[model samples]
Target: MSTWLFDLGNTRLKCAPLRDDGSIGEVVAIAHDDAGAWLDALPTGEVACIASVASDARRVELLDALCARFARLHRVRTEAALGPLRIAYAESAHLGVDRFLAMLGLCGAHAALVVGVGTALTVDLLDAAGRHRGGRIAPSPQLMREVLHARAAQLPAAGGEYAEFADDTDHALASGCEGAALALVERSLCAAHDLLGETPSLHLHGGGAETLRARLPAHAWTPEAVLLGLARWHVLRIA
Candidate 1:
């Protein structure tokens, strides 16, 4: 039976088929604003598994649409422990499912830092034994720009390039916001290294992660971390 995995974030909704080998097929990303109309075109599937960090109303809308196309719909939630990974949150439900899934998807036999840059910048660290070491959340560079534009009508919402010394307002905004995010990632990596007594692998994901690729050359990029986690969740559920 064909299984579809959906990862609904604050800004985008990514969907793909889960292969027999547990790998994901081609991922299709749609803006949240266009998700409802796009869902109408989704192929029928035997099962639909989702990991959503969107608002409750948005989740309801997507769930309703998925319920229409699939006989079984599984909405994955944050868990205290899933297989090897043990969540640090005393209240697991308070942890974002997306973050939990990302860690589950990327955690390996070594310490690793998973940084997701989307509507929000999320950083989570997992040790070699799959123990959650806690995480942090901050406004993404794009969100920073939006917030700036909202507060200061004169500042443009978009259009900028990162630079050490920005010559224009646009570049300044871009550099500042991007630099802020990069700084956080760098700081986290340093702290993770100190805490683990060894350098932890850095994993980057989400829509905004690409912007940091040039700056974070050493970090491994895993765009489908959340969806991959959902696939893993499905495997664990059935096993």
Candidate 2:
């Protein structure tokens, strides 16, 4: 039977099955809080192996509620023996496990600038040689927009979705959202590129990927990189 894999991310929980090869199949996305509903609706597969950046207590809260149905369940953590990628961060423990697994999935034969733009924006770089250099995180686009809106009553709500502007307010809203998101992405990618010094495969993932994808240069790649990477990580772990 195929392996049942789950990547519990900031805003969405991705589920899929992995073939014997490194490739993934049939990806499913669910809101993080609605994971239980998915559990009740999942096919008759084996237990789940979860990779979560969220806290252990939350995982326990979820698992305790789900353990009855999902068997052989495992949660991926920094503590999990990760033999695939070369973890190069000085504070690897502080780094999100989802980001780490993503680094693995998208690494392939080329260097990757892995960006996870969701509840929080993260850009973790792996050198062409598969060396895990390091990455950074910042408030997500939504968070940034909310912050300004909360402080200044004039700024309207906006997201990473690109749109034409009609007035200063609209322009500010559109640009503020898009600009803040792309700024973090560009900053991280530029920092990584300066060190890697090569045309890396710029891969984007997470709940915010769709909105942020458009703002990215056409040269960048964002093909469910994190999900694929998480799938790849599961294969190496159990195979």
Candidate 3:
């Protein structure tokens, strides 16, 4: 039997397998609508837990399906323990519990930066004094791309690996869009540090993180941060 931990972001969904001994066996992603069928395509094993922020109807369907598939289905609630820390949303109960749980992994003796960069980029700050000082949400990489595509008349195609381009219309659009996103991360990290009056520990997660990691400043922990946090989540519980 294994637990299924799912992080459903705005544009994509990420899933991980956690063994009883607190090991993260596999991590992957799939389209949001395919969640039900996605699990059906996998080998059957008891699902110890299930977490989602997918959608109202979709969540109900997935929960029902997961419950049918496993005896225990622990849908991650805001207060639910995840990775390493307890979640404390400003609204407390109203906040999506996953953010809270994920923050636990973001916190340290130094100020912590917990960012979920998906269809929207949410940058949260946890001060060194253990304060959940709220956060901000900005356009995600996709949103930025769409904005550029709509506004720019002849922007060059970007993505599919980094490269230098002529500073033409397309290049400007691509660079501005990508640069804006990169600047958003850098800006938020710097702002967090400025507000906290100390260097904040940066931990970036969610779908768009990796694409922007190279363009970010020194503290950005994109893929590794999320993977390590997911692994930590497993160790904290069900071990």
Local distance difference test, each candidate: 0.90, 0.68, 0.62
**Which numbered prediction scores highest in TM-score against the true structure?**
1
* Residue-wise C-alpha lDDT for candidate 3, range 1-239, written one tens digit per residue: 55666665544556667666655567776665544665464333465445455677766766666666677765655553343344445456765545665676566676787777666777778877656777777887667777666787454335433435544655555566667677776787778777878778777777667777777766656453443445455566554
lDDT of 3 at 115: 76
Q: TM-score-based ranking, best first? A: 1, 2, 3
**Candidate 2 residue lDDT tens string, 1-239:** 54667776555567777666767678877665633564454443555667776556656655665466555676666532354477776766876777777777766678888887777888778777677787788888777777888998677766333555434665666666767778777777677778877757787776666776766865455556666666666666666
lDDT tens digits by residue: candidate 1, 134-227: 9999999999999999999899999889999999999999999999999999999999888989878999998888888898849788999999
Error of 3 at 24 (Å): 1.9
**Deviation of model 3 at 109, angstroms:** 3.0
Candidate scoring better on lDDT of 2 and 3: 2
Model 3 segments more than 4 A misplaced? 34-36, 80-89, 147-166, 220-239
**What ordering of candidates by lDDT runs from best to worst?**
1, 2, 3
Error of 1 at 40 (Å): 1.3
Clashing pairs in 2: 47-71, 105-229
Q: How much RMSD separates candidate 3 from the native structure?
A: 3.8
